[model samples]
Target: MNGGPRLFSILRQGPYLIASIHTALDDSQLVRFQQDLVERIGSDRARGVVIDVAALDVLDSFASRTLRDIGEMARLRGAVTVIVGIQPDVAFAMVELGMDTGRVVTALDLEEGLAELDTYAAAPPAPRR
Candidate 1:
């Protein structure tokens, strides 16, 4: 692990899961991390994911798109994705850029985000076909 606050941390809170991203999430890194997350959730039986983004100083188009894609991908795998610690300025920038963040659940801080994950996990699962 890189000593610089770690790029990400995968934590399991009962049936809920969190991927606390502690650095700027670029495209290549996001892809690899998402794959790792999928695998982790597969083994851990987690129902939701909280992506912590407090340490990121910037959110560009590529990063924003990657986040959206990750969220969608996680959802396809039956895991809800929440974006946490989005700075106000960064959030504004994303909105200004026309990035549709509506699909992403947002939280002001990591703890709040994790709490949301707990709620999602506790909720009833969707009915299967």
Candidate 2:
């Protein structure tokens, strides 16, 4: 279980679920968030997910992996995942670490994330590889 109250909020907007992380979460909390998010994606029948990590000053490897896994899990449930609001420092560190972004897409902010989803929706579907 998470160590305390939820550290983030997930709200569904239309076909997208937005998860805003306003603070750093412990390992357990991060895992819980990932699980809860994936479950919510299925339950809500979301077509896309936006994870905003603007408030987090650091992005450790574990967190990066968890984000990637969340995207992959959501994809398996027929949803796209976009990560928005990555601070410049965190983005630099992620680049320096050669972090693999995997299935998640990145955007400048929530607006752009939602726009990305909109574009995805308007585009023709891709054939599965």
Number of clashing residue pairs, candidate 2: 0
Clashes of each: 0, 0
What lDDT does the true structure give each of the candidates?
0.79, 0.91
After superposing candidate 1 on the true structure, give the runs of residues whose Cα lies further than 4 Å from its correct spot. 1-5, 126-129
Per-residue C-alpha lDDT of model 1 across residues 10-126, encoded as one tens digit per residue: 888777677877777667777777788888777887778888888887888777777788788778778888888888888888888887555878889878877887787778887
Clashing pairs in 2: none
Query: Candidate 2's residue-wise lDDT over 17-128, tens digit each?
Result: 9999979988898998998999999899999999999999998999999999999998889899999999999989999999867868999999999999999988898998
